[model samples]
Target: MEILMTVIMGEIANRSISFLIDKCSSAPKNQDERLHDLQRLLLRVNVIVEEAEGRDITNKAMLYQLNMLRKEMYRGYFIMDNFRSQANNEEKNSEDGNVSHHFTPSKLNPAKRLFFSTSDNAHGKRELQQSLYNLNNVIVDVSEFKAFLRNYPPLYRQPYSMHLFLDKSMFGRQMEMERILNFLMLPEPSAPPITKRVAVLPIVGVANTGKSTLVAHVCNNERVRNHFGKIVFITENDLKDRGLINLKDRDVVLQPNSPLNGNGQVLAIIEFSEDIDEAAWRSCLACATCLGSVVKIIITSRSEKITRFGTTEALVLNLLPLEAYWYFFKVLTFGSADPKDQPRLESVALDICKSISGSFLNAHIFSSVLRADLSTTHWCMVQATLRGIMTRNACLSYECCVNRKNPVYVRGRVTNDLFAIYPSTEISSDETVPETTLPELLLGGVRCEGKFEVLALKSRIAPYKNYTNTCEMLTPRSTKAKRHQKPR
Candidate 1:
């Protein structure tokens, strides 16, 4: 009796000690300390996401929370990584005897403010605080996530590094993919099956924001293919007032062999560059009904008006945040090579990314150029060229299509002449492309006269689209002639 009583007293004492320790630790940590915790939490969340990616999760609520978690993870990672990059850059600048980065505000000491300026330091603090608050709220909202996570079995670990993952899979769209896949695979049984009121999903986003790629990826999924019999692509050019009846010759058929397991319904993929009206969408659906129970209709457009047409809620995709884009671009640029090994090159790579804005095609193209030659000299040249291009028109890199807002001109290195440039239409895998790639042109190894196409980087993923810009060689706009012109 005495020993049992002693043990109970000891247990109470231990619990009390533990409780106090937990309370003290939980009491607001310092900024740097809190960031360390945030990093660990984000890594934990990343592992969970990687596991979740391989499995098909159906809980809409869970899926939504996962999206929030992934986004916060990216934000947290960005903050931490940016600080590290700044610190290293400061150290590198010191070693190279370089005065300092062209940090804004001249009154500040260049040596003292290596990592950040007064404004930057204050701004960074606020950003970190807001990030922590937002992440905490997301975690609190999804308190039961861990409990649900236990139910799903883990798949074999995928050996995908950041760069490899970016190369193979769609970056920043895993949750979106899962959401769409679940929608297609398991139709809502609550709706009468006989009516065959087929589901329509409208994917809306800005131009070149992967709206089309997402639809194509979901359509090509094995599970989705097994659920629907026929897959057809209908472009803005293919739509007729009569609806989808005459698509036999018009639309491209993706899958012909019936999987024998599916419900034997057609899956129509419609793509539009402009806003599609209510009547046109309904007509497509009406024609779909005439075709005997089209199970799914997937449409993608840049206009948000398409959202009204979805039977389910619309999925909107935007480009990654600047920090996230930098992280991705850095990985792609260094690829298998460590950024630590070449800090100067890494700094230059950031400039190149900014010059191109958020253009994914340009990201791939320039990253390829950087990776091809890891030397700082080559990277610097690329940076200067991109800067020159931006000086002409920055938006040129943003859009893959030819209808650019401002004309782009590339000056001949030797001839000192300017040539007008325009991007060509999408080139497919089987189609013939120009011999001179975009990198070749920027490198200035070869210069040709007259109009010709320069092949930009091609997609390694589905849709396999490539960009080729047309360069119209022209007589140099004679600055000498302007100099001699008399005042009007």
Candidate 2:
């Protein structure tokens, strides 16, 4: 996923460079210089990132910096593309206008030409320059990271499959699952009435810790199936009222054809992304409350903040124990947890499992990398790389290890020792306001505004890659200034 993201950004930069070169003749004198500088900087950074793609990037901060640079580059690319497009349209319209329309007399205004004049895109030029300058700084930071990684040479690196096969029971959280079931099944004593029988149950955890898989298990439980006659699993795209039921202020009346229309108990399994419309979600909750039958909601998200949406306390999923992780790793790698069953590979399997911090994804990938070879020498080499990555930061938890490439995730809310990474900012003055005001929609600082444009570019540039369709990152550039238009 990370490699694909960088490649998409590079493709955008490549297209933007071509666009700038083709249109430089009509652009402002200063615009071409900035564009060329940006093109050069992006090309250089692209080369560096591609070189490091196959190498293990163990540091979380360095990986974050690389992603930030990609984002800034994408923003720059779109800004340039938009400006070029506007310039082309303006020129086209000028040529197609009425021939005799309001020609300025040369004697009255000597500097005036007979043709229409285009406004100087000075604001866009400046912003373009600023974005390039910021991106250059990010490149410098990434260069420092490259230097740091140079000290640790690349180990036995292999292309690993993204898919993983594992037993759900061995992934931990049995006790937590039981707790969630109790919360969903048991009726509250202090509850107001049947009309207000709705309850929100949010399952919060970090990425790749099997949060989705765990939710799937609970949703498929036999008891849960019996309790709620009407079960609807909705994703971000299915939130519209047309396909589903319309939600009004007072009551939520389901459509006759709607699956949730009946008076039987209803269970909604909503997969919440950070960018979902808050008003729509609130309306859904209100509609549930208005529904005559008992309604239960199970929301799965990486954000701990979602817990506040539920009237009852949210359930937090913790990391699996070392024993559970071993079992998971053994089954995934050797098809069984018993080392005695596989006498030849037992020692090497234990060595690899111990080095891993209990991430099933990591184990899956590493196992593939070492799958062809059962020799002790090759196993020891792979184990050494894993240990080195882990020991780089002695105090590292599995979260940090997984976070290196795992993307943004949610943890517990702030306590005495722990503070929020993005603490709510105080709006003391208008000057203190950020340039972009929309709530963050993408996890791991990804912007979503021009996601379609980026993906469109990616598909056109490199359609041969099978996973292009799977790489869904939409975080887009900050709001741009309105385009300048000529008066009629």
Candidate 3:
């Protein structure tokens, strides 16, 4: 009976999603001339990007070119979406007897002030000409690319809804994923492999920049699983101790599956959290032999020093540019609801994204808040608090501090040694989250008197990791004592 009921509910959900997709897809495309042109340009670029993602793009120059095209595609969309939103805002304001069609500096939210500095009216013919020229040059360079794109089959069918796509997709990572996979399934390639003495691939990025997530997806691929006899994950602790040397005895062997293919070949993934030591790296390579004949060693680290350990060129990851991140954040914030319909909310959401400092985790958490309560007042309140928090830190991001494994203040308060803090983390599906969430704490006036865990973030993307943090509360006497310790 329960199984029947569950099946019925799931079917209903599927039908509902399909109906919405049909409606959105059938809706009229942008009628405005400039938007129509931009949309067509973006569509062509999308075709190229989508095609490239499917094939094994080993050429570094080609990968770089593909990346440049992606940047321009994103920029084009950013311009299109903002233009659409502004037009909507103007029409609404004109109807409401506020026909000035101008947003004053004072009227703009903190986010708008940070990101949208140029006057909407200032986007003259000269600027338009320059943007078109840049975009055209990219498309023109990739002209041969389009002809070749048809030869390689696509990786996956395109999704109908942006909502569903963003939910399951790894944002802005298609090219990188293809490259990593190409490196992993090597030597028998249509392309070249790394040098013979056990290939090494190093991936470097700062804290919380999708390094783990990217590698996790690559390692889980069926091709990778079938190619190696054993796939082992080694952490900083594993390398520091004699963990990897005695593999089976260690507890942190992250993902262990039966050797599907008895090739007796091993692939080792080392999370080098600190600067790489040449002697220690050599020792790691030595330990790799004990597991099996090492096929490849993928080392991921926050330190650039890891590049020295790679047999091939290292893959370095960086955060998205301001405009690109805004595009991503905007999509996440406004799901089915059209941003054009709620101009006020759009302003607030933009500011909130600005304050987040490109933290993907924060994007998940705050977008949930916006989704939970889709009110302009609620959004404004959250934005004000978020902006205040950023201001108090002198714009040193809470995300960066958390990513660096440092304790950071989440609110505006001047304090000393005995102050409070929230130490954040990203948890997997098997783990449990606390009853209290970071959004409630920051926006809903939720408070607790002692140390307790709070859900800081929950990603909708694959692996669907959730983030939590420990909230430290101080007693009145302790707080007073700390404040008095400092002489003004």
Candidate 4:
């Protein structure tokens, strides 16, 4: 816990520093000095925290002290984050008008007071001094905790778990993999030849539906290897400050003077996150179009909203079928061995399979938890825990297409046999959504009347129009552990 908390503190500090440097660099002249000073203090604090982190501290008292310091650092980080976000927004607004020269007499916002001067709080030098002092006290005496300063390497977040794909563990995505390959490798004659030359293929689905895993699979396919002369993989971290064009042309490591081949084709696979700037996408598209080559792009995202950004929808991955899901679950738990080989666990394993719905990610997670103990007692405990989570949700189940938002009721049937259910609401086309909505279970165990403000943006594209929509209910935490989990 101490190590993970320290790592998180480091990440927060790093992000805060990067945010200030990138966003506050163009602040008003009066605010430049304050921003620079703040950045300097943060840099000092970051160095201390990093140095302390490099040393392996085993002493319990020392560990507790470090944790206390980490808490203080977290508070500082929150304040810094608030300031940077405000400044970023203000900077955008400032671009529409001329940059202000004089400091305003109006009472400054809490964040602005840190930099902007007013009659009441002149220069904010005292507050800045106090902040630096607190950071200094928290980070003081690092060498006392360790015999030597170990040169620890900087941390980098893995794009996705390699364990999922290792030892031929990936399952039930061959059809989706082929769909991406068809879009990239197979030519579209109906569309304009030029537009087809540089087309955007979007892989849209809910979170943890293996969107990244699917893209990685397609990128590693044998056919993809022969088609494109050049391929570039873009990660979320790669677009920290630069746009996509820079990432493709400048950031990516490419061979010198490697010109396009006969087809003049370049395949770029981007793992798109929700926080991605629209300008970055446009910049990348413009660069690809100007390259005079057939730039086939594959982008993976959770929201169907990205379709509004002039992208052609290629694949919408839904949950796997029961048989395929069971195969996936079996592999994750029992490896290559047959689950029936173990007579003791056969019945318990079948119950687990039935309870998990069709989420491959959840299956992998729950199976791992079950693998910890093969005894019937542990299996029953796990089963009861999962059932408790499902039964607590008060909702109504309806049959609906996975790609559509509106739920369709089955005539003369109180109970329907669908793998997934969606919340009752109308799908909207508005792309500018302010919040995200997670779905809840609608039937069985407990019942309560209610309505939810759900955000279900349905896809209108063909083939997908008939896709079976599954509700994003509570998956086992072990499935999404990486998301909520901090790196140690």
lDDT of 3 by residue, 300-350 (tens): 998898898888999988876766777778877887777857767886776
Best by lDDT: 1
**Model 3 misses residue 401 by how many Å?**
2.8
- For each of the candidates, give the backbone clash count: 0, 7, 1, 4
Off by over 4 Å in 4: 1-167, 187-196, 235-240, 243-245, 248-263, 275-280, 290-292, 308-313, 341-344, 388-488
- What are the models' TM-scores? 0.77, 0.41, 0.74, 0.42
How much is the lDDT of residue 431 in candidate 4?
A: 40
Model 3 error, position 467 (Å): 2.2
Could you tell me the TM-score of candidate 3? 0.74
- What C-alpha lDDT do the candidate models reach, one value each? 0.69, 0.51, 0.68, 0.51
Q: What is the lDDT of residue 480 in candidate 2?
A: 20
lDDT of 2 by residue, 1-488 (tens): 99999999999999999998879854654444566676678677666654554455545565566556545654565454444434333444456773433332233321122112223546765677787878778877776777876755453366432123242232345455666677767864555554466778887876556565666666666566656556666555556544444423322223445443455667777765443456767756765555445778888776787887877788876666554455456556655333444433654565566666556555655665556465656665566545544443343366654434321222111111110122121111222233322112211133332222111111011111111111223121211221132111
Q: Which sections of candidate 2 miss by over 4 Å?
A: 1-170, 188-194, 237-263, 273-280, 287-292, 336-347, 368-372, 384-397, 401-488
Error of 4 at 44 (Å): 68
Flag the better candidate by TM-score, 3 or 4.
3
Query: Where does candidate 4 have its weakest 10-residue lDDT segment?
Result: 410-419
lDDT rank order: 1, 3, 2, 4
Clashing residue pairs in candidate 1 (N, C-alpha, C atoms within 3 angstroms): none
